[model samples]
Target chain A: MVLTWAVIGKMTQRDPLPDGTMRHSRRRVLRVGALLALGGTVPSLTGCEPFNREPPPPDPLAPMVDEALALAAAYRDAATTHPTLASRLTPITEAHAAHAAELARITKVALPSATPTASTPADSDATLTGLRELERAAGESATQACLAAPAERAALLASIAAARASHLEALQ
Target chain B: MNTRTPGARSAHAAALTAEYAAIWAYGPIGVRLTGPAQEAARDAEATHRRRRDTLVLRLTDAGDSLPADQAGYALPFPVTDEPSALRLAVEVEERTAGFWQAAVAATSGAERERALAALVDCAVRATRWRATAGITPLTTPFPGRTA
Candidate 1:
């Protein structure tokens, strides 16, 4: 009923993160080992192949890191598309950048060199609404990640989640 | 496998203490405002009271000891005007959310959920207060992070 590691798998399927970032976060060795053992990665009859040569499972926080970067990009694009709203939207974009940087640091994942460019809707109100929805979903995902995280990591996830949730009001 | 309401006991106890402080501070905040703002203060106080009672019961059920609520908490700044009261309300919620955030780290399962709900609730309220006071940047980058 409570965090059976299924949550991490769920997040993995929900967000398509770059495979490059998956190599980081050594803390995941145990989880990866558990996954390999459970998956029966080897076909050898003796099952004595102690090594799980298959690539490591993606770090559970990688998607969040990716999501943070995406949100930042979306906000940045929105700001660029609608210069009149830049004053209000710039701070949120900056916040997401900070969140992404912190998450990347914690996971030992390097951020993408170039921020992806996303097309913004023609209507500024529509763009703002779209941003709000993204923030809302991001907040919900971060909340789940916080619950699934180990104690040491939960605090940052909690803050990220809360910050995202508060952004709804900022958008309004 | 043991799963007896897992979390650090001290964290939730501290959250309980925060609720007590929130409830206490709302008195000065409520007195400074009239109309809907006053009502908002009343609702906020009642919310804190309910959470305090619920947490007390939960800790008791979990066989975890609780810290007692004090008679009063010193106000960070005097609530002299409507603006100041609104500001205090925001501060109270933010500070309360910090404790809940720590609880979220220290806890798991239902306790973590409760702490998270409290944190979100406080963050939202803090935002509302900021918006109400005409402050810029309604949301903080990290709601409960002190720095």
Candidate 2:
């Protein structure tokens, strides 16, 4: 049978179960339906709780934010160590910071205070090389995260992955 | 291949539409570029076409009817020169990435894997186009998102 948009819209508005328990399959349906309805603007499903439900574990999004911040720090530290590369590196660094902020906002979590670990480059060339390595690693991590992320968060993770991949090319 | 979920099937269909557009946009984008840039556009177009074919097969196997492509698509802007062509390339990739992003939110398992790969591919391509255009900050914080 053909799946019409109207049918999917109805699925998203499903009421909570009588006992206040939701099946995994049904939850997946609701999440997908909501995503389609929002046109990908919905950040996360955290706010979809019906009420009286137990809180979830550490937010899955926390790691993504941490990774983004780490990438930003890497770029910033590299620029500081090699001032000549500052012009080329600074904008991307800020982009990473923006990513971290957005991810934190969507996840409804505070930004972590701990500083990210950064490499100390010996020169401008080394700084570019080191940054390339960092971008590659970050891209891989983001791709893996996208693969495992829930439907609600997969788009964000995929975008992060893609951005990092492009960063790798730019560094070249 | 669980086509039982209407959301997943519909999202996949949407992705197919985006892929169709990407393939068509590349025709104009490639002709305006030359040398290595031209080759890159050709490669990008080939990749989109391959993806579109693969998605068609998967959707068919999942028992969903294929959506028809548009007779023609309106270019976001006129592509009268090299720079404009590159910009269109970037826009096409970003637009397609948005559809795959939506698919990621609407599917699971191997289907989700396909969606994620498509999303990432479009994003990376867009970034490369931005670099070619001498657009600074060669990457966006979020590839498929507007806000």
Candidate 3:
């Protein structure tokens, strides 16, 4: 003979009357099904209630990754027009790429795959001004991240922020 | 090891969402960007694509449901000029950084490490944007910025 245990609740209590016999019910089976359903529900729920759900909020890493990617773009752009800075800029761009990869690893998120158009305004003066302005904004973000997160995160942010500082210097 | 837990998986998914938004923001960003900036934009986009693939595998391996990327995403504003583009770039980084910060709180151990790394990465990128924009006081003091 063969014995198989189906997915059912087992309640072998001492026979209330005399000889020992067990009684089973639908309640246990229902409970297990509910757990499975809830497990599936949470992920979907996150999408529905991105703001309300009391789970840990979204990671701050997204901005950092974006910034890193942006920095790479900026540096790469500078390298083309200002070949003098190409060598100096390339490493910085690479650093940003590395930072983006590291962050993606942590968040388990996909990075974008689209290329930017690099549309500079028609005016050369405007182009220079815009570049300067952009650099400042990038630096500010890194500084804010360094200040806002915990020690480990703060330290990491600070280092990246420092790198940005160097970029700013190079731009000058 | 603990990647299967609700907390851990949520963190991972959040990271992916940020990546999605960053990818979207690049379109407008690249338009105003020029030269090496364009190449960097392309490379960044490729990086996101690769990372996105990695994320899908990790989530699936950990028994998590992966979120699908939208065919089109709405931009916060029109990308008419370089200034607007830079502003949008800042906005994207800040928002995405907040998401990763949330993941850090939601997870633990290796998951936590990844979340923290993501958070750090965002913060760093944000700083770079600020610097490019010539904004002072670049970067957030911490990750998971609320405001």
Candidate 4:
């Protein structure tokens, strides 16, 4: 166990980017450290006490759910404004809604009731382009979240990220 | 009930196996496609190969045992035509992404990054295959998740 932890420690050190800066963000470094500390085999520290001491700062899923909802709303608004694109946009919007619901269920959090601010693109092509940009940003966020997440949540985050990437392609 | 936990090595091994299968599967997928589609299949195959090579190096450096690729694999279904081939391509990418998702759960740090990137790659490829196949929606709410 000790050897395993040491191996993980060595592996977590960020590689230099092309510009010679470390790849990890400060938040990622902290998350990695917390994950490593949890991975350690010290029996006394493994009890429920440490984990139960304070609730985690916030569930990352909250923001993820919000993003999904917002994306869905944007698609819906786009569809309403450009009725011609409704048939094409509706399915993607519905998929986003489903994603938000599933994420909320998994996190055991109540869904947010706030209405999403919709995109007011001027024309059909602009709507599609705006959607493509939205999907790209969401995909990037999900990718970063996947990298920062622990083992249990990583799969969900990765899947969401991948879905968003595909959404971008489909939007094109 | 068994309480055993599988580690990062096991997950990485699973991903390697999926990559091996993906590389083999693309041979049939490419032959059935034409023009740009065929070129795309070839590019996808190369991507899997590159990932496989990287995984081999990472596992080797970590002193983890590597799984040997099979001489051949059984296709999920017969790929005798273009439609079947496109479907197989989609299946291949989705299946490979599943393994990478598991790897994301089992590994950490650089290994996790690799798994996440691979997962995204497979997802995007799967979407393209779906589009080529004329599958409706063309994207999933969750790429790797079955439920």
Best by TM-score: 1
Q: Considering the two chains of model 3, state its CAPRI-style docking category.
A: incorrect
Tens digits of per-residue lDDT for model 3 on A14-130? 223245544333575455346535555434333333223466547877767776777667657766766654555566667667667766676676888964435445454554566
RMSD of each: 9.9, 10.9, 19.2, 12.4
- Candidate 2 lDDT tens digits, B1-147: 545489888988888999899989998898899998999999999999999998898789888899999878899899999999999998999899888888887877787778888888888888788888887777776778865
Stretches > 4 Å off in candidate 4: A1-56, B1-6
Candidate 4, A107-131: lDDT as tens digits = 8888889868895678788889989
* Model 2 chain A: ten consecutive residues of lowest lDDT: A43-52
Q: Candidate 3: deviation at residue A64, Å?
A: 23
TM-score, prediction 1: 0.82
The local distance difference test score of model 2 is 0.80
> Which is the leading candidate under lDDT?
1
Per-candidate DockQ vs. reference:
0.76, 0.48, 0.03, 0.55
- Model 1 lDDT per residue over A1-172, tens place: 2232452443233222487433423345466446556755423212322233455556889988889999999999999999999988898998999999999999989998988777799999999999999999999999999988998898899999999988887888
| Model 1 C-alpha lDDT per residue in residues B12-93, reported as the tens digit of each score | 7888899999999999999998998898889889999999998888778778878888999999998899999999999999
After superposing candidate 3 on the true structure, give the runs of residues whose Cα lies further than 4 Å from its correct spot.
Answer: A1-172
Supply fnat for every model shown. Answer: 0.80, 0.80, 0.00, 0.88
How much is the lDDT of residue B64 in candidate 2? 86
* Residue A2 shift from truth in candidate 1, angstroms: 20
Q: Please give the range of 10 consecutive residues that has the lowest summed lDDT in model 3 chain A.
A: A1-10
